[model samples]
Target chain A: MAKRSFLIPGVDKRLLIKDSLKAMPDFTRRRFIAGGASLGALTLLTGCDVVDSSSAETLLAQVSKFNDAVQAFIFNPDALAPTFPESAITKPFPFNAYYDLDDAPDIDGKDWKLEVRGLVDNKKSWTLDELYKLPQVNQITRHICVEGWSAIGSWTGTPLRDFLKLIGADTRAKYVWFQCADKDGYNSPLDMRSALHPQTQMTFKYASEILPRAYGFPMKIRVPTKLGFKNPKYVVSMEVTNDYKGGYWEDQGYNSFSGS
Target chain B: MASLTVTDEQVGVTPAKVIQPVWVRVMHWINALAMILMILSGWQIYNASPLFGFRFPREYALGGWLGGGLLWHFAAMWLLMINGLAYLVTGFATGRFRKKLLPITPSGVLHDVRAALTFKLGHDDLTVYNYVQRLLYAGIIVVGVLIVLSGLGMWKPVQLYYLVMLFGDYPTARYVHFFCMAAICAFLVIHVLLALLVPKSLRAMIIGR
Candidate 1:
């Protein structure tokens, strides 16, 4: 039998012993030991030992993965984020991004083409007008930012699920990655569940007006259920793939599935 | 020890009763630690995007960044919820909730408030809880439950739509969560101060009298 040392050093052993009278079940202990072993394996899998910061990053990433699994398991596809009336729309919706508004890329809408790649059957690129011709839907939903503030905005666009169906996308793929035209290569990946959400749209208009450059001019993926960063803006290309392609902020330690 | 004796003399009493059971003492300390960690880390998470105009000072918040803060918050959240549930169940099973924590009357509360305001409040009995103590404890427990529900609403707004709707909306739920946290913090301040002022009461909770 392996010696188990779950308690941290310098903790009050008397209290712990007293508390452990309400013992956990045997299966829970076994599962926890297995989890701990996998955590060690994860550290090794990242090709780093405990001495390096990479090990810590790997552990954080593993925890994030666990979080993603828990969230996905609990997610209800049919459920929707609460919608608000137009009267509840926040006026002067705040513009937020890694770059300043003035530095937002000014792309020629007519010249832009949305390149499609990976497991989709139809690999034809899409023009903005071509996308606008798809069945459109409007929703007034709250845009929650990780930074703590939220604003309600009216958005209109084709649902990404509908678009994926049009492109004959392999809907069972694990990830849907987006490549954005924003500076510093701002991009994000979405889980298949979120990608298929009815509210997940390839947004063209905001607040009944064509999306301003500050809000992703050509197009934005409006995912109301996810935190703001997960909804990548100015998207130029999309790939449906089984491979794990880490995102810009995700590589920096933000959880890949940052659902609020 | 000497101060205790002097205080006993001043109050004309002797402390010998077992005021807190071992379970109560254990649960109390665990809850205290869990709440402290949760508040500190919650502040760190809140600083990521502050509700108000300004952010909490970075030094006061726990967990270095948004990621670290979330980790701490989630871990402590489980600790708090589970331990809190155990405490409640054990408290009821042992009749402690009925004998010590319950039966708070509005008039008794008013009397205790007046006594406190008039500086006539007594701490002669370490084995029994005063009306104010009972009321505050009951109020904090309710607030703790609200905090947990509101937290769930914020964490899974879609799955827990009814909970979110109870608070009006998602942003409003966040605000309510913050407000409940502040209320618990305020209760903690008063609780700690009262414990210090009546040192024997603190000792009773620690060593079970």
Candidate 2:
């Protein structure tokens, strides 16, 4: 049999909605109960939005609390940034906003010095050449950006531990501070767990070549486990510290614990 | 009463009720959530490269985690697809699509268009809805389907070869997905405003009499 399609003219479909209700003459007790159950389900779904919003807030709070616990434990006077192997490199990293680095020192390679100070037994400033004379470390690792991008690159630099030992890190210092030449004046606060990860370290090679100066020029701090913003570039000084501190992006609304 | 003009001949109008059944309402709210999640996660993916100047920090995610964003989007997409299809099928089988939701006639469309434009021109007790609401609802349904189809085209280019061919290429499919999202966002803005303008409209959908 050929089906005749239902067609209505000049009346909005919504206007005729009541007709559907009228057709069900047996709006019995069971139907009412079923309808109620469905309505309850509808209400529950409506509350999902609010539930999702609160759960997100709770997660953020927990992350912050975890960072706080790490901050409370104190032991070593100085810590070193971790080193990585050269085979695990990533590519195509982007420079973050350097809103804090505009007015800093020019850091000419000739006079560049990495001042190691504060809470250390021996506060000393080592020239770039002197610092480079130490054991060099290299690693290939992903530079995950806080802005949602990832790049793997080979980085070459002296082991931060080598620098710490040279300056005679005391038992009181627990964190290392990086003072960058880019005027960013960015300081990173790291827990011992991340500060000494084997895959974490400073680097100067990218894509199997000398690292571009545009990345950080003379030298940069590389913490592979954290977001790229935490890896300060054009680093001028490495301060050993027992006191807690934060970096450029951290102050401008970034996670201090920024780890995997 | 007749002298006082309370007669049916004097007014010649009757109110027609609009009922958004439990199934339709549940499906609607779920669809809304899924779309919102898809958009939020999409923004996360887009932030990887700011095609425009806008940027959202990777740490800040709608789902509070970058990985969670992707998971929720995919999960919600499946739910929306299943529920949407169910709505369409049940709507048809129960004859509700034809009797209450379908607009298969030219005059029906014309009346909707006219009523949509001239808000106050209809009789005071007219139960018929103007065309604008139907048009918007129909648009949401159509665009929703397109977005899902285009999404599949991107999700599996080789498997969904026919769907991808419809859009010509993968990038073209992405464009369709993006524009459909824009349409949904636009509709939402207008829908909310209209709801505010006519307060009883939203209540009617939620607590139908």
Candidate 3:
């Protein structure tokens, strides 16, 4: 019929007078049905303030885990992430972290030790000078972040595969878990295949200069293939193990194998 | 029971032709569902680092946040890819693609464009796809394929380096994916309007009567 006000049966009639402003039911019914379903599904996924074992959060987590396995299977270690020319380097490379810049862990180079543990023949920790001396190489590669931004930065360091070999790390292990000095204990697990990538490095310098405090000083594992978060910074200890220890963001629903 | 027993052909009555076969109808509904999930979740993912300036409203987004958006996107991606592959394979194997969307000519499209603009386009014959429908249906197929490729390129720039290279780079591939989504949304508006304008076509898609 025509645009006009209508009443609900009884209890809800007074509360819904604003509904009279809407278009004809024939026009708006389908839109409402579709929007309602979407809103319903959104609430289903997020409305539960408490995430338990049997929740949709767990279901999505399981899918993320499945994605990790798919990524591992599809990962070709020989296929390298494209490297850029020196000129292509993103000037003043963006500094990204869960916390603000001034709060980045401040550590003295004189006191820091790269602790090595688990499934490695060499349990000895290495000093910053010792890591700096390991046959160095440089690469300008794109750093892709999960937030959908990317930057190219030149990093100089020894390949993680070579360093792992030098440290006598067991290659059979599934992951190289890095524990960082960030106040929130920000950490990440590096998959073995990615850890062995030719370009993956335990970086010591940025743009031929000593790594700065703002850019994870002491060291940052530069993984070009994976999303930025997978590249843990200010790493203090590493354990080569079969265990899948959840990470800072990974535990909060981010996919563990966030590589591209 | 007698009505069911008596054949339409034997009784000198024309049979109701099935314009969309059972498989096509099944796959069409599935594709429609998957497309909605993908587009909604993708909007949220794009909002994370939008290429252009404006953002899709949060209420319109499917997932609650970035992480949730990605989960929904990846989940729907698998469904879309599988269903899409099945559509292509069966369509090609059965010559359905050739029958429905072939012989598309520039002149025919222009004529249809003129007819559509002036609101003179006819939908009396549901079985014979008009030139506009053929062109749109065919063009959307190509767009669908490119969007998936670009999505893959963005997803695995390293493992699929060669694929990403075809689109120039990661950010460029993101642009292609975004434009493809835009094209699909455009098509959806027209497609839905036509279905509404010709309600019998919508009935055929649903009940296949």
Candidate 4:
């Protein structure tokens, strides 16, 4: 049913737009001003009337893609994010995520399996104990947040590059996408180069202790070379793929390849 | 470069010199607009995680929100870098920097500072820059370059670790970037006041006389 048209049958479209504009004082002032700029640029660039907020957002979204390319271009696979000494580690490293500390997924290691999918030859899902049996390396590195805060924490895990190699993942795949256990199904795509970075890890422990609930129990992808969000937490599965599947934040305008 | 000068026939006397060329005028306005957008959006970004306790009044900010602020900031970043680079390259290529901002001695700068404080500094020849003006312009240019470099260092700290090291660290680079922005803001206020104080110079920039 045409519910909106039923209230005011055969309403003049132009008058409807005009009256709506009059009602939206804040939108007319703030969004219109900002939206008008991108509208102008978009009109020039695309040669069409993309006359709404979504279209303007589209223009900005394109810039994020451009940033992804630039980030990838500038990214040095061999250049490591600097490691800190034990003394330099921030005391009580801050727990951060889209959700509150209480809401972190209650994961049982016995039931939780690290599912390997996509191009990896080894599709076996490893239990927490099995995954922990692999070689572990530790590094004290800064976790830089998108909001401009940073903290140093020591993480211990199997190097993702070595892990991927062991799993017989296709090295030429463009992305290693992670699926998390968060309620929102939080996920992220890690670029192949960054995925293969020496420091990238399938982290199992933080500060010599089993990963806490606040810090993603069972697993988290530790990507020191990237912003915090890129390091997916409570990671349940990882797919080695050539496709470009956007992440929760990346889909919402955060740069895809937000590598430092 | 071909100069845009009024011939003696047009003025019916001596040919007039072009104080600001067309390219310089275009680049100046573009840089000014770009810097304004950058600073305003940057303030919004700063408010996300403030260095100081106080926030910039919201009305002065450009973007409506953090995401919007970032979009505006990143968009203007390209404009500022490209235009600033062109300005510097063109300035050096034409010896404009040397001609307009040279001979800045400690005594000369001191003399101009005294003259400026006493309101005795003359703006008779709009073509010529006083020692104070010269220093301010040169200082701002350096600040502009540093801000871009520091921004790059922050943007890719891991990739550009060498550059970050030169500035001490990531946090220091951020502080340097903020201070450079403050310097630019200060220069803008003084530059605008001086322009309004001497309208002919402003007209020279606009019309390129």
Candidate 5:
């Protein structure tokens, strides 16, 4: 058996002799004063009712200037959020909401196609199977909600950027619009910066299961960096354009640029 | 030791005239505690969304802390607002406003900016405030007000009536609230760093100069 030894700072026994020689009156008095001051401050915090209005107005004015300065400071052409490893994901996510799938044309794989149109030289439609054949990207990210609940899950899909590249997305295009099927009028605008986020993919599988109807079955969109509302579900068709047409939430007054 | 001529009531040095009046001190601590609680509860709220791909859905459940966190947060918020208002009143009535928190001129701000860029601080004569501190303190107050207004804009859109148009609507107000909070977090990072950089300046607030 091994014996363990640890270092500890032991109190010196000579403190009693030192204390006897020191000015005990001053020491005790100072301690008492300090204790009293702490009590007084605490009392002031709980009992006092004395906030000055002038300070509020002055502080308010100073704060407004600061807000302007911040707005001026944030001028950048391009920036992006990072993607995380799939291993960090949570599995078997509970389905909360789904949208725009019922109106999807129930054509067979050969006939079913996603149309990419508006503001692009090469407009084309790709079949769902064709989309699945493309290079895939998987990401694990937390989905934040406005109602204040969050879920972490693994999403597997092809990046929207890749699809846009395949269609030769016009250089002037400012927004990518998703026109979905279930027809509860689901659509959203994805700006350039967010459209190219590495984690911003069109998701198919939520966990290991193919998406359920309650969770945009078959396929859906996922925008990791923004709020969950930005990730429109039951995605059917996509349109890339420079003009900002109102989407479902945009019409409801959600921010058009909800980048994290 | 030989103070025969000196009276016990010798008033040569008045204890450093209380620069931070009782009201100011009360408001400071209340605001501090309230802000901290808000952040913690806000996190529990944020936990549901984790805005930037961070989530701890089971944290509160695992730790048994979510409910208490929310209660503390809302309760402190009320205290924060009341104390903040009280401080505002005291500042105007006591005329302690101009005495401390002197106005910073553009040139003074410019010099402070340079000092901040160079990581120098607390040279009171040369630099009024390291630019970052002035900017952060100033920004925090603005963000705080925005949060309150935007929160109202969301919760009582009908009452604030005019805010709906300014911030867009409920969802937009939510965005503003979230964005302002993000700004606060950014300020907090810098604030903690500055606190570490200059200990005495941080102490001045607590010890009343």
Candidate 6:
């Protein structure tokens, strides 16, 4: 006698159903499928239509946006990333960038001015000295890379929230975009909540020394809560805007709001 | 429930009751799918830096690239967490934990180990889980919790400092998470092997017989 397959057929149909449900734009499907939906129910919802790869990608992107909204909604403005003791800082911190250390841009600090653009009352650029004059603070925090390694480093700079306030930027803006001085025009954007986090800094120094060329000579935004890539180095300009200006990696399908 | 019990009068075998419920089987397969995707995508992500000397092969890894792997990892992470949580809650609330998994003793575990090592373990009765099965199930539950906590620590080490501290540090937490994943993979190997050897067990899990 031939052996009978029991659950395999059902499992395959269920997977197809799940795929169709995921492709649907309606949020009600989630609620309806809360306790798990049957194949008949899924077919009824999607009309048994096949979702192509492009449609699947679009659905996935929508899901990612939904995740971002949920994360932003739950984020606490006052909550701080953990700060470590000075001794805990990783020595000889590994240099990470899209390019080699030798390729790091040699910016002329004396001639350079931090450009302020977009929705800000004051459009005045700041010299390195002027940025240094802002109330400075220090933090020993971990820099978690997207790739699996992590390192602790001591960073010092002006609080980004204070700087935004001083610049008379609209705090209600959706994103604070960074334009890097790197050769590739590498950049990233931060949501309002992460932008205003206490540890988010317009960093100017590392381990009591002036920010080295390898670590963004003029300035870097130290956002501890986000993955390392979100902390765009070699930052030359900043823009406060409601428009969705995607980042370098973000445009390549990496999550825009990469907050932990 | 009574109809599910089976006895062989001619062979003089005792009656065996159905062990897996429909919900248990559903949770089992969902968890299996989530774990498989997570492990595969996690390997793809690990290949980005590699704590060890070598990296996982592209063909063997899921998601194709680092960005794609991250998307898969984060997506499946929610599935694993939510499904695992529901399984835990249901297991405890429905008394499945107390009735089927708990009350394990050192002596009972020792006896089961001896029985297993000596090849004296029997599968004639499928109603009750053996001491070893019970212990392994409990151990996997503990490891699952550790994996989630360590993953959280790695995900938001700064925000979830206490979880990071639980495993000594961030690096340590990463190592813990990796090893837990390895442990689960090992369990899966043994589980599938045993299921093949005892085909009825597979049928029970699938059909809740």
Q: Model 2: per-residue lDDT, tens digit, A1-260?
A: 43222123223244344444445656564586588896575445334454566554444444355444553453221332232355434334554554433443445677766676676777767676665666776666556565444555667776555555566775346777777755536667665545555545555555545556667756777776566777777776766677777777666545565553
User: What TM-score would each prediction reach against the true structure?
Assistant: 0.83, 0.45, 0.84, 0.83, 0.44, 0.85
Interface RMSD of each: 10.6, 17.0, 14.7, 17.8, 17.2, 8.7
lDDT of 1 by residue, A1-260 (tens): 43333222322344555445336677876686687896576335334442465555555556566767777687765578888899999989998987889888888999999999999999999999998898889999988777667899999999999999999999999989999998889889998988998889999999878899988988999998888899888999999999889898887767777776
Residue-by-residue lDDT tens digits, candidate 2, B1-209: 11222323324554345456657677777777767767877666555555467766655445554434544454456556777898788877887656654564668777767765776534332234445665677778889889999887664343354786799755577678878978988999998887776766677656542
If the candidates were sorted by their lDDT against the true structure, best first, what order would they fall in? 3, 4, 6, 1, 2, 5
Worst 10 residues of 5 chain A by lDDT: A4-13
Query: Sort by DockQ, best first: what order?
Result: 6, 1, 3, 4, 2, 5
**Top candidate by lDDT:** 3
TM-score of chain A of each: 0.80, 0.62, 0.77, 0.78, 0.62, 0.80
Ranked by lDDT, the better of candidates 2 and 4 is 4
Question: Which prediction has more favorable TM-score, 4 or 6?
Answer: 6
User: DockQ, in order, for the candidates?
Assistant: 0.21, 0.07, 0.18, 0.15, 0.05, 0.31
User: What alpha-carbon RMSD in Å does predicted model 5 have with respect to the real structure?
Assistant: 22.0
CA lDDT of each candidate? 0.82, 0.60, 0.85, 0.83, 0.59, 0.83
Top candidate by DockQ: 6
- Candidate 4 backbone collisions, by pair: none
Clashing pairs in 1: A147-B49
Per-residue lDDT over B61-165 for candidate 1, one digit per residue giving the tens place of the 0 to 100 score? 865788777765765676688889999899789888788877899999999999998989898886677899899988898899899999988877767889989
Preferred candidate (TM-score higher): 1 or 2 = 1
What TM-score number comes out for model 1?
0.83
Candidate 2 has a DockQ of: 0.07
The CA lDDT at A121 in model 2 is: 75
